[model samples]
Target chain A: MDLRQIWILYRHEVRSALRDRSIVVMSIVIPLVMYPLLLWGTFAAMNFVEGQAERLTSRIAVQDAPPAHRDWIDSLSGMGGVSVSEWMDDEASARESVARGRMDAFVRFESPPAEGAGLEQNFQLRVLYSAARDRSERARSQVEEALVLYRGAWIEGAREDLGISDPEWSGFAVVQEDLATPEEATRFLLALMVPMLTLIMVALASFYPAIDATAGERERATWETLMTVSASRGSIAAAKYLHVATFGAMGGLLNVGALVLSLRWILAPVAGPEGVGGGGLPLSTIPIIAVGTVLLGLFVAAGMLVFAIFARNFKEGQAAITPFYMVTILPAIFLQSPDIELTNRLALVPVINLVLLLRSAIGGSLALGPGLLTLASMAVTVVLAVTFAQWVMRREDVLLGSAGAGLWEFLRSHFLRRKGKA
Target chain B: MNREPVRTQALTKVFYDESRGQVRAADEVTLSCSEGEILGLLGANGAGKTTTLRMLSTVLRPSSGKAWIMGHEVRDAPEEVRANLGFYSASTALYPKITPRETLRFFATVNRYPADRVAGRVDHLIERFGLGDYADTRVEKLSSGMKQKVSIARTVAHDPPVLIFDEPTVALDVLNAIELREIIADLRGEGKAILFSTHIMSEAEKLCDRIAVIHGGRILATGTLDELRETTGLHYLEDIFVRFAGARNAGSAERENAG
Candidate 1:
């Protein structure tokens, strides 16, 4: 294939794409401005909802409690956002009230855990609430905390009466410490949002360009003219693929940059300064993330071109590419779950593997073996997609959108024919 | 004698349809156009005019038979064939976002015109096509006629020895059509072999040194206008086409009824 011809085609496509307003908006404007706005809007909404939830009062009902316990529960009335009411009914009735929203939650003492069971056995208090109802769930936790505080006060009084001063009577004290640095902590939070968002943005960035270069040319009737040029079909396809991949890579870089800036400047301050480190993503992991992102862009760009070329027009191309876009994005959604990791098996999958690799790289946990395997697998898939695109370009029926006979029709005419049939 | 600039030997292309079985879009069509001559392909809609031009342009491969452009086999040396031929159709379009100057430059470069000569060739095409006024304007903002001019200029930017025009004046206005006819005549004078397809009898009568009437993917008649008139004893080219196409249609109907 002639490199000069390919370069000519590539330069023309890129120049044309750059002049398009929508392409400019999607690849550059959206990453730089829309992302920060979206981040700011989401954080503002979350804060507002949390404040509203805190101000709402929760009603709790007490059932099957002794007089002494009832008095103790009554003291919770003075606490903020908690309303205590006595229920003179069976446990079933109290539970019905909580379920019906007449009460947020109900606390029941189970006969002091049976008197003869043992002194070692603690009192059994059951808090009934529906997790589906936010207020009921909140009330259950609040009541549990109140009960624990009351129990502690009672224990201290009993100890004073027995002249016991040692704190060991309660239990051994447990101390917890987090060994992660500020950067490591930020990486986890950033990994949850950045890699997935970046993958999706890169796919979006390549979508319009890929479709415009392939199906859009056909729609405008320029594809035939280009095909009649001296350039080989493979060279033309390679040039288009390269043009699309550049957009994807640009999108990835812009998104990563915007995300880091937003997190460090905008979101971190809202998250009270400890949200993300001053410097986002360790310096050591940048190379891995960058390489992984570029490879993913190449893979996505080639895949989009193959799908887009199957369409006969711009609208049909959009329809054809939407499913692929969804397929690429749906797997990246799984990246949101922190539990998913870059295992060997996951590293073999396409979009998911890239997201996982990015996640690992950001978190500084990327193993060389799995990382290299992911990159190699992505490269092989990209090569296959590009080859398929070139082959499609060479097929007249495909490029012309001519309706070719289906396999079933071919079978009916040949293999399925009866003996002596003309 | 002199090497034919474009030649096809039983160049056949068959398309298979589920309901119609094998449809012969172009069937055993043997034809040639020598340098300094214009050969007109006359056919009705779906009469394989576009298909034949497509095959010769190296845009489509023939199922059976062979086509050559300046001695380069289309199947074996498609790039070489494309390099030596300039193919244009009503469907040929320009990149909307780029100026005509850029479009010409791009085509010239891809056609492998010498890097040093590309600018000169592009400037010449702009002046030749009278595109200088709006040559730097994006194609999308240009008029339909201007776009057509740009398309034609780009096609001939490499100055190939053979030219193929498939209904090149289909959507053009009368004045632009006349201008295009003049251009084709001038190219023929320049010794480029030209194969043009059109249904307009006047176009063929005025420009073609020889005309081929194709019906149902087969060339039914091939001769100059006077030769065809004498052979059919018809006074006009339209009457001659009517007779051949009518007979072909009747023969196909008879075969279908018999089957």
Candidate 2:
């Protein structure tokens, strides 16, 4: 309970952690540089693939179009990346050619154009393209667009010939109006990614330091040195908890910050200019997200420290704590579907609640009941994890690696034991 | 009477090994070291030397009985005991990244040393231990000899009245071992009661004011070297140790047969 002793021990860990190259690199440098590199590499690869797909020509065979539509049919050949060839074989053979990649598409009008009742040709057009082939699908779409344009032009000519006004044919038009604010537009984009990112980055950040604090001390033969100091085991645990949690929170924030800062550039191609039209989150939700981040840091850092205490060395510590990384991530992954909302029951689930809470906050409609439950849920988990870690730290055999018990035995002894027993 | 700086009464520790059930690592060890005294626990490996010292330092909890550091019971007041004691063993190592000066200052602050005296105490230890040349260097960057000196300085950083050294020279070279003995002797000269453990007979004979012979988790005999020599009629401390260890093992076998 001595603040002075805890502070001294905390400073001890901080000094060691700052100089420990692995901790610095994992928690600071990687988070700072990783997002930008990932965004750049992704966009570059996407552009290359799209450019390659665009430059390939679409070859289509046109068949049985009357002289009235011949001009428009021939225009397909004039369009860029489109080649039109007349079909001389049976329709079956032409369809086969499209499927086998000999032709990208087969454009066939019904065998005969029906004479319309009043100066209009009534014919059904069938465009055959292989869905499995990208070129075939593109060719069909190109031909379809050209045919529509040709029909519109013909209608214009026919109207002129009949002396008809434009209002006679055009009757209705549909216009779309979006009333979303800039904050809402950017907020929806956060719900899907931020939850998983926060958990994963915090978990990763907590890894090396927790191991260094517990198993690293044992390996370096300094655990006994620390044990003999005047600080209580609980104080030592608290100091270590503060140290690891700081790194975890810093890492998650840095990565999220870098990504949010570059949100416009990263989303421009996919979401268009309006993707990040205004760069601001709702002021009310910032505190919620901040609390969530802090809670996540505490829970994950305490859990990592608990698991790491079971190990006698760094390698064993990593093996011991690796399962925690997956368990931390699996809940986020389970809540991947945004429709997974925080019902009263789901609100108490650990990582899922955080995901839902953050998602609801980003979407600008976080209900008070769910938000409080989420905070309480995470707070309880943090307390339990930290308490268990502190308890383990006080055990002579666990701290000294003298006991033969592993993870299962530790848990069994803790959870399954009778009242008032060790 | 002089105050006992380190005292234990019937202290014991039992560990359950998978192959060997219910092993008593330290059994009914009753011993005490007074002010300005050097007491040695001499035994072979796994003869309860480290275990007894570990109990006194509050590293290992005693399964039965009690140990006190400067009259503070280790079980009830662990931090209190640690505040009055300094422990240095092979396992009590210096932080690789911390300089010796920082190590001393940090330990002093943690052990509740006076805030104003910390800087002076740290400087004194630095010069006293001849760590001036490498005092600012990280422990990992220092030579083994230099690191050894820093470790020794770190042990008494808080200027505790009671010190326990559990086989600290087990890994040191012969020359370094001799140097460490001299350092320990100097600490005793400053009136610190030290409980030193070793398996080496010469280390006990030359350095310890009183030596306790331990075997099979129990202390077979405890007295000054001259008193032990007289009682056992043995010239060398090594033969006396063998005789004591053999007697304990033979007594155990005979008791088992009778049972």
Candidate 3:
């Protein structure tokens, strides 16, 4: 309850944590190197996969092809995702064969233009397939793409009046929006990372330290000295909890800062000389994120402290507290999925809210109420966790780590005797 | 007539366990210590002496008993009790990264001493404990004896009315132990009620005004060394402990309730 005590504990905990080389590496270095590498790698891999899928081909049979346009139509077979074979039988026969799953897709080419008269050149390429088949839709799309490619040259020749000769050779017209706001784009990109990273950082910062300070103390026999001090048990627990929570909050803030810096540097080259426009998220959201991150850190720390305090030793505390990481990580993983909505009910869920909020921020659809609700829920959860941990802290078995055989003998003689008779 | 610093009546603690059922870490134990007195609680590893100290310190809550420290009820006024006491033991861990000076100052600040007084108190403690040579060194770099000295300094940084030690010299060398014994006697002389737990008979005999033999979560016998010797019909305190703790009467309820 005393702010000074809490601050004192927080300061020392932060100092101790910073002194640890592993924590420093995890907090600053890993994210600095890993975030850009992972994001660039993922973007490159996705593009590669899409290009490969576009290049794949499927064989097709041609039906009812007229003589004049045979050459033009046959040229379509060379395009990607397409393979063509001539129709040997009549229309009825081909139709029957197609229905019985005899072909991937059957394309019928219409008659070509006559000589001298200049009859309109039009080709009806009908791709036939049963809808129920797995590859039918894919087969249909491939045929369509090949046809477009084959007629591309002809379409350009027709548009020669507009100086469009050799249309196939003319490259695409690039419409650059000249997006000037790297901060906005960065926010968008980070909306996903921020939520997950914040949760993870908070949980990590709070959990291990709380256990080390409390249950670890008991296991090491240091809790005895701590108890003997004139500080109240609650005060002691609070001090420890506040100290760890501050570490968690610091981690979250550092991660966010690192993410922002990385964004500015990476996007600088691509946003052209005229820097990205739109003043990122309003300044108001900064406070929200900061406060939210701090609260989450406290919640996780208090919760973890409860568990750590109850654990018999460092190893036991770890075992007790490790499952919480999953709760923190789940929100980040769910953010990766494309199909999700930020809703009021989702806000009440702990890490899930962080994910949704981050996604909304990135997508430029952030709703303030949901984020506040999420923060409130996190606060409630942490309080409950701390209270439960305190309850366990009050127990002797947890405090003394079974106390060996004397405890068993005392239980047998003292109270169990009365219980058995009843 | 009003010098008692610690008082307990039927102090007991029961722990519920999922795998092995229930455990009683401390059983109906009543005892008292006057101000300026050193009471030594002697027991084997699991004899509930630590648990009893924990209860008296307001660190562990008793299941169905009452304890008072510095005239404050441990159950109802834990904060007040904590405010008036200092406890130390071998098991008490020191923050290894912090220097002895920093650790002592941190404790002092938390106990709400004036900011100006912290430096003076810390310097006095450093000199008193003979830690001037390594006051700036992190606990990780300090010798075991030096670390013990720092722990002692940190525990008494606020100069509380009560001081408790649970095997305060368990791992130290003889010289450090001697220094600690002197400090304990000095603190008692300054009118601080001191309770300590130790297995060493000599340390108890030298320091304690009264000694209690604890076993199986209960205090079996308590008296001055001569009083215990005469009552148990044994000249040595260890023999007296063995007599009470090893007796068949101690296991009578255990035998009747065995399933």
Candidate 3 lDDT for residue A74: 59
Q: Which ranges of candidate 1 are over 4 A from the true structure? A: A43-170, A268-274, A335-337, A403-422, B1-3, B250-259
| Chain B alone vs. reference chain B, TM-score for every model | 0.96, 0.98, 0.91
Q: How good is the docking of model 2, by CAPRI class? A: medium
Predicted chain A of candidate 1: TM-score: 0.75
Q: Please, what are the lDDT tens digits per residue for candidate 3 over residues B195-238?
A: 98998888888889999988888898899999998898898777
Q: What would the per-residue lDDT of candidate 3 be over residues A1-422, giving only the tens digit for each residue?
A: 56666677667666766766665566545544555665567657887978866775655777676675665555666554666788787777766666676666777765544452354567567678656654555666677776676677666666775575555445685667947366566565556556777677666656656666766566656666555554555556677777677767777777666555544554445554334223333455676677777777767776666555556677777876776666666657766774676789988887677667666765577787886788778778877877865655555554555533232343464468659767
TM-score of 1: 0.81
lDDT values for all models: 0.85, 0.86, 0.72
lDDT of 2 by residue, B1-259 (tens): 4399788899999987657968999999999999999999999998989889988988889999998888899999999999999999988988999899999999999999999999999999999999898888888999888888998888899999999998989999999999999999999999999999999888998899999998888989999999999999998999999999999999999999999
The order by descending TM-score is: 2, 1, 3
In model 1, the fraction of reference contacts reproduced equals: 0.82
Question: For residue A261, what is the lDDT in candidate 2?
Answer: 61
Local error of candidate 3 at residue B212 (angstroms): 2.6
lDDT of 2 by residue, A1-422 (tens): 88888899999999999999999999887876677778788888999988987788898888887777788876777777887888888889988898899999888877434455345564667888999987888888898888888888887987889888777766686678879766676677677777688778888888999899989999999998999999898899899999999999888888777776666566565656566655535557777777888888888888888788878999989998999889888878877886777777888888778878888987877888988988998899888888877887777778788644466777665566524355
Highest TM-score model number: 2
